[model samples]
Target chain A: MKRNVVSLTIAVLFLTLAVTGVMGFFLPFNILTVSVHALLGFVFIGSIALHLKNNFRQLKNYFTSKTALLVILCVAALVAVILLQPKPVLAILGLSKNLGPAADRFELKDTKMIYNYTPAPHYKMQLNFKGGRAFDAEKPPRVAIWLENTSRYHLKTLYHSKAPDAQQMLPYWHYKKSEYEKYKAESEAAEKAGKKQSEDVDALSSATPNESFDPADYIVPKDPEKETPYRLLIEINAPDDGNEHYPDQPSLVYVVEVDNKHPRSYQVLDLVGYPKSEMDEEEGEIEWSLLYADGTITTAHDLFDSALLLIERSDPIK
Target chain B: MKRHFFVISLLMLISVWVFFAIKAGEEKTSYQSFQGNIFGTRYQVQYHAHEQLDMDAAEIQAQVEKLLQRIDKIASTWKANSEISRYNRAVAKDEFQLSDELREIITLSEQLKTSTGGAFDIHHQGEEIDVSAIAKGYAVDRIAEYLHDELAIQNFLVEIGGEVKARGHNAKAEPWKVAIYIPPSHSHIVGPRVTLSNTSIATSGLYFRENHIKNAETGHAPDHDLLSCSVIHPSNTTADALATALYVMGAEAGLAWADQNEVEAIFIKSDGSIIKSVQAQR
Candidate 1:
C-alpha cells in the first residue's frame, strides 16, 4: 500500500508538470503556470527519489542494462540540444517573450523625455518678453511663434498676432502657412476621392488649430513625453522698417532646437536668418528660402531685448 | 533492441516536428489594430475576424472613439459640461437626477466603495466626484462588448491607459497575454505577465512622486509599501477599482482581502518583492 501511494503520487505529479509545461509553451507568460510548474517540479523530484528507494533492487538491475544506457544517452542529448540554444529554439522562445500586447512593453527608445512632474498638465513653455529699444506701443512687432520638425516641417503655430497684416509681415510663416493649406486641401481632396492620403498631412492638419488669436488658443503640448527634437521659431517684423539693404527690412527669424531627450532649464533663441524668396526664371514659381542677416537688419535685431524660453514644470527637482 | 530504440527516437522527433508545423500553419490570421488618444491617455484595440468583418478598421476605430467620447462626456471631470461635472456643481440635495450612464457608473463606484471597505471612493472631502480612475477600465469593457456584440468579433483585446480587457484568443489562437509594468517610473522592467480569455486586468500604481491616490475614509493618500497592485477579474470596472482599493489597503491587508474575496491579485512592494493572492497563485 505504501509503495502504491508513493508511485501514484509520482505519476500525478509528472502529469501535472507535463500539462503545465505544455501550457507554458502555448500560452503567454503566465505567473500562475510558472509558479505551479516550478513548485510541483521539486515535489516530482522528491517523489522520483522515493520511488527509486522503494524499488532499489529492481532499479539497480536496470541501471546496468543496455536499455538504461540508451535512455541516459537520449536524455543527455535532449538536455544538450536545449542548452545549446539553437536558432530555431531561440526563435520559439522569443515568441513566448512577446506573448503580450505591444503596448504593455516599454522600449528604452520610447522614453524621449524626463519631466520633473507628470508631462500632462504640468510641462509648459514660458516665454519672458522684454521690450527692446525700438519697441513701439502703437505698432508692436507682429510676432509668430511656431514649432517645426527637424526637417523644417511646420507642426503647429503656438501663437500668432491677430493683426490683419500679420501674415504679410511674417513672410516665412506665411509661406509655411500656404504650404500647409495646400497640403490640407490635397489631403481633403484625396479623402473625398476615397484614395489613401499622406499620414504626414493628416497629422499636421489635425495639430494645426483654426486661425484664432484668443489667449486660450496659445496652448502648448498637453503631454510632452513623446515629443522629439523640434525647432521653436519666432518671427518678428516691423512694417516699413527700411534699411540700406532695401526699402523694407525683412522679418528676422529666431530659432532654438529643443530636444526633449536632453532637456535644459532655459535656452536662448539664436537669430538664424530671414526668409528670402526669389521668382524662378523657368517656371515663374516663387522659391522661398532663408538668407543670413546682413548689415540691413538694424532695428529688426532690437525687436526684442532678449527672448528667453524657459521650460517649467509644476514640481521642481530637488 | 538497439535498432528498436533508434527507430522509436526518430519517430518521436518526427512527430514533434509535425505537431509544430501544424500549429504554425493554423496561426495565419492577421490582426487588425486601431489606436487613438482617449480620456487624457491612449487606447488600443486589436482583433482578428474568423469571418468577413462588416466595417473596415477605420470605421471600427471611429465607432470606438465615439463610444469612448460618450463615456467621457458622462464621466470626465475635466470637461465643464460633462454629466458628472454638472452633478458636482449642483447644490447638495437629498436627491439629484443623473444621466443613465452617470448613474450606472456612480452605482458601480458606490458598490466598490463598500466592497473595498471605503478604500476606493469617487467622492473626496471638499473635492468633486472624479471617476477618472474607473472610467478607462469601463471604457475598455464597453469597447470589448461592442467588438463582441456589434461587430461579431470573437477574438479581441482592448486596452485603455493600461486597463485591459481581452476576450477569446489572439490571432495565433492562443490566450491573450498582457504584461504588467513597473510603476512610479516608466521603465522597461516588466512584472508579472498574465494570459487571459474573456477576462480583464487593471493595474494601479503610484505614478507620480507626489501621492495621487487617496483613501476615502481619511481623505489622504495612504502611506504604504506597495509600489503597484494589479487585479484580474471578469469585469474591467471591478478590476480597475479593486487595483486602486488594494493599493490603499497596502500589501498585508490587500493580500488578505484578496484571498478572502477570492480575487486574483499581484502586489509589488517597495522592496521589489511580489506577493500573490491565493486565487492568483492557482
Candidate 2:
C-alpha cells in the first residue's frame, strides 16, 4: 500500500511538471500557471525524496555508472562549445554579422561620451524687512503683502506681525474668481446635459479651489505640512471670502491694507495693477502701485517697501 | 530490470529538481536590470525568466552590446568609418554593398517613407542615408528579441533613450507601466501612466536634447507648436519611425494620419492638451 501511494504521488508530480512546462512555452507568462508550476515543484521535490529513499542503492549505482558520467561530460562540452563560439552562434541566430567587423572592433572615445547632466536653474529674488510700525502706533495691525508673478499668478504671501493668529488679508482682485466662474459654468452645463461631470469638476465642487489646490490630487505631496519651527503657513484666500469679518473675530479675512497715522475709519486701498511680462527684454521688473479706496494715489515703493528684502548669504548657524 | 527502472526514474527526478532549484534561485533575485550607453544615448534592459537560462547577465549584456555596436557601425552618420558613411562618401551612382542588417533597416525605412509620404525618408538628397530616427528603435527591438528568443526571457522591458519595447508581466506579475511626460511642463509632476504588455512605445519631440528630427521635404525642424508625438505599435521599429514622422507632421495632421493608418499615438500640444489616437482611446 505504501509503495502504491509513493508511486501514485510521483506520477502526479511528474505529470504536473510536464504539463506546466509545455504550457509555459505556448501560453504567455501568467500567475496561475507560474504558481501551479512552483507549487508542483515543491511537491515533486518531496515525492523525489520518497522515491530516492525507496530505491537509494539503485539511484547511487546509477550515478556511479559510465552512462551518467558520459551524459555529464556531453553537457559540459556543449556548454563549453557555446561559450567559446559566441560570435558564430550569434551569427547563426541572425544576431551577428559573420563577415563584417565585429561589434567591439571600434571603441567609443571619451570625447564623444557625455557623463554629466545639469538641469536648468530657476531664478528667485529674496527680500528682507526691518522694523516698520503699523498704521496705529498703539494697536498696530498685522501687515500682509501678496506677491504675484508676471502672469498674475499669486506666488506667495508674507504676513509680518506680532499676532501669529492675525486675520488673513484679501486681494483687491483674484484670478481664481474667474476660474471658479468658469468651473461653475461647466458644472452647470454638464448637469443640464445629464452627463457625469469630469473628475476636475467633481473635485472643484467638493473642495475649495484656491491657489494651493493642485489639479493632480492623486499624488501625495513629498513634503507634507508639518509643525516645523521655521516653516510659515500661508493661507490663500478663497475666490469669494464668504461674508466673514473681524473687528476681533479671530477669523482670518481678506482686508484692504492701509498705511499708518489714519484714524480707525481710514480709507481702504482699491488699486489696479498690471503685471509686467518677464519675457520682455526691456521691462523685466513687475511694476505695481497702491491706490486709496477714496481714489487717492500712492507710490509703488511705499506699498512694496516693507516687502523689499535683500538676499542674505551666511554660513551654517552652528 | 526493476532496479534499472528505479535508477532511471531517480536520475530524471534529480535533474528536474536541479532545474527547479536553479529557477527558484533566479526568481528570488528576479528582474535583473542593466544599463549602459547605446546609440549616443542611454539604454536600459530589465528581464525576468522563471526557467533556467543558459546565459547569465554578463553574457546577455555582452551580446546586447555587440548587437547595438554593430547597429552603430552600419547606420550611424556620426561615425566616419561606418558603412552608411562609406556609402555616402562613395560616388552617387556607385552600387554600394550593404550588410544584411543595414539592408533590413533600409527596406523597413523604404516602407515607412512610402507610407508617410516621404516624411520618414532615410536618404538625404537621395544619397546620404540617415537612419538615426529608426535605428534606436531597431536596437530596442533587437535587444528585446535577444531576451525573448535567444535567452527565452518573456517578461522583459527594453528601453533605448525614449523608445521602449515591453513584454509580459513585471516583477510583481503586473503589466509594465510606462509614464508619458506632458510636453513643456514646468513641473515634474507625474504624467499619465500606460500599461505595456507585448507592445512597443516611442516618443519624438523637439524637447529632446538633440534637434535631429526634421521635415524631410523642408530640411528644417518642425515648429515647436506640437510639443511631442508618442507612437505605440507591435513593432518597435514601426513605432519609432511613426513617432518621428508624426512629430514632423503637426499635431492635427499627425492625429489624422495616425487615425487613417490605424496606429496608436499620443500628441501633447504646446497648450498642454493631450490627444489620444483611436487605438489608444480604445
Candidate 3:
C-alpha cells in the first residue's frame, strides 16, 4: 500500500509537469504559469527521490548494469545537444510553436513608452442660476446659442430651443426625421424612374415665425406653473486635426441672450448634432436639456447638440 | 546517500547564484524606451543605459502631459478658450499683448520667414495664424532636453510623428539610422537612409493632406514638383520648419536654397527621383 501510494503521487506530479510544459507554449509567459511550472518541477524532483527510495534495492541493481549506464550517457548527451541548439531540437520534436519565452523574444527593440498616452483636451461649461426672488422653478427658460471660429465663420450651434421641444412642446425631431425620410424616398423614386432628383426647397427653407410675436424675443413666459426650471450645461471635444494640434484657433463666444438679468460670456465651444436618423435608432441618446435665461427652454438630444446650442447662445467673452 | 544529497543541494544553490549574477550584470547595458502621445502626435523615447532610468514610467508620462498642456495653452488654436485662441479672437489684434512663449515663437517665425524669403510664413495678413509646422519640432527638442538634463539620459532617441532627434550611440553602439520614405504615388519608392547622431530629422510629405502646405504668396497650396522633403539639423525646430519651407520652394529653388545654405536636405521628386542637398552628399 505504501509503495502504491508513493508511485501514484509521483505519477500525478509527473503528469502535472508534462501538462504544464505543453501549456507553456500556448499560454502567455506570465508569473502564474512560470511559478507553477517551477514549483511542480521541484515537487517532481522530490517525487523521483521518493520513487528511488521505494525501489532502492532494485534501482541499485538496475543502475549497476550496462543498460543503465548507457541510458544515463545517452540522456546527458541529448541534454547537452539541446542546450546548444534548442531551436533545432524543438523543430525536430515538433514543439517549435513558441520557440522561446515571450518576454525575451517579443521585446520592443526600437522605441519605449516614456510617457503614457492621452487624447486631446475635451472641455465643458455650465450655466447655473441661483434663483433670484422672481425666478420660477417650474418654467424652463427659452435658449438659443451657436459658436463661431476666429474668422467669425459660423462653426456650429451649442443649443437650440427648437431642436429640444420634443419633451415640453412638440416632437420636432420626429417631424424633421419624417421630412428627411419623405425626401429620401422621393429622391430614390426619382432615381429609379430615371428622372432628375428634385430638391425639397420648402423643407430646406426656414419656417417664418409669427411676425407679430417672436419666441426668442419674448423674455418672459406666461404661466410660471406650466414651466420646468432647469440649469444649462455645455460640453465639447477637441476635434481631430488629422492627429495633430493645428495652430487654428477656436473662437468661443456666444453673442445672443434673452435676459439681461444674468449676462456672462464663455469661451469653451464646438458641438456636432447626431442626425435625426441615429437619434431614432439609439435610446438614451438625448440626455440633457438647455434652459435659457428667459422663460424659454430646449432639450439637448446629445452632448454635441448641447455644445452647439451652448456655444450659439453664449456671448463672446471680451 | 546523505553526503550526495548535500552536495547536490550545494551545486543547485551555486547555479542559482551564478544565474542571478549574470542577469544583474546584463541589466547595465540593456536598452529601454518610453512612448506616449502628446500634441495630437505619438512620441517615442528609447535609451540605452547601464542603470535604470531616473524617472519611472508613470512619473515621466505625467511630466510630459503637463508640459504638453502648457504648450497647448500657449500655441494650440484648437482650444478656443486657450491663450492663443483668445489672442486670435481679440478685436485688438494689432499690437496685442503676448506671453513670453508666444513672443518667442513669433520672433522665431519672423526670423525664419525672413531667412526663407517668405517661404516659411506662419502668419498671413487677414488669415488665421498657424504655428503647427514648427511647434511639434520644438516640443520634441523640449522633451529631449528634459530627458538629457533632468533625467540624466545621455544616449537616447526621441521621435514625434516623422520628426526625430537622436543623440549618442544606439543600443548596439551604432549611429541612429533613419529612413525617409517617399510619399506613396504610383511607385512605392524610398527616399534616403540617413545616419544621425546628436541630430534631428524632420520630413514633410504632401500625400497625407492636400493643400496642407499653403504658399504664402498665392494664399493656396503650392503646385510643387516635389512629393516630399526631409531636413536634418542639430535643432529640431530648424529641421521641422525648414522641411516645410523647402517643400514650398519646390524642387529647383528648394534644392538651390539648401545647397546655398549648406543645409542637409533630401527631396523626393514627383517623378520618383531622389535629390540630396550639398551637405547631405557627405
lDDT of 1 at A299: 85
Candidate 3 runs further than 4 Å off = A1-318, B1-30, B49-53, B125-127, B183-187
lDDT by residue for model 2 (A118-178), tens: 1101111132232222122243333334433211333333332335433333322222233
lDDT of 2 by residue, B1-282 (tens): 999999999999999999999988767677787766545455678888455887777777878887887887788775567898898898953577888888898899999999988878888876778888898889889888888887888898888876878999778788887766442232232244577889988888754332467687777778658767789898888998889898889888888999999999888776667889898898
lDDT of 1 by residue, A33-91 (tens): 88999999999888888898899999999999999999999999988976765656545
Q: C-alpha displacement of B276 in model 1, angstroms?
A: 0.5
- Which is superior by lDDT, 1 or 2? 1
B1-282, model 3: which lDDT tens digit per residue? 999999999999999999999987776546677654444444667776546566565567567656665776688775566677788788877778887877777778889999999999888566557887887788878888887887778778877766888888776678877766433242355345777788888888665444568889887777867778889899988888889899899878989999999999888887778899989998
Best of the candidates, TM-score? 3
- Which ten-residue region of model 2 chain B has the weakest summed lDDT? B182-191
Candidate 1, position A41, lDDT: 95
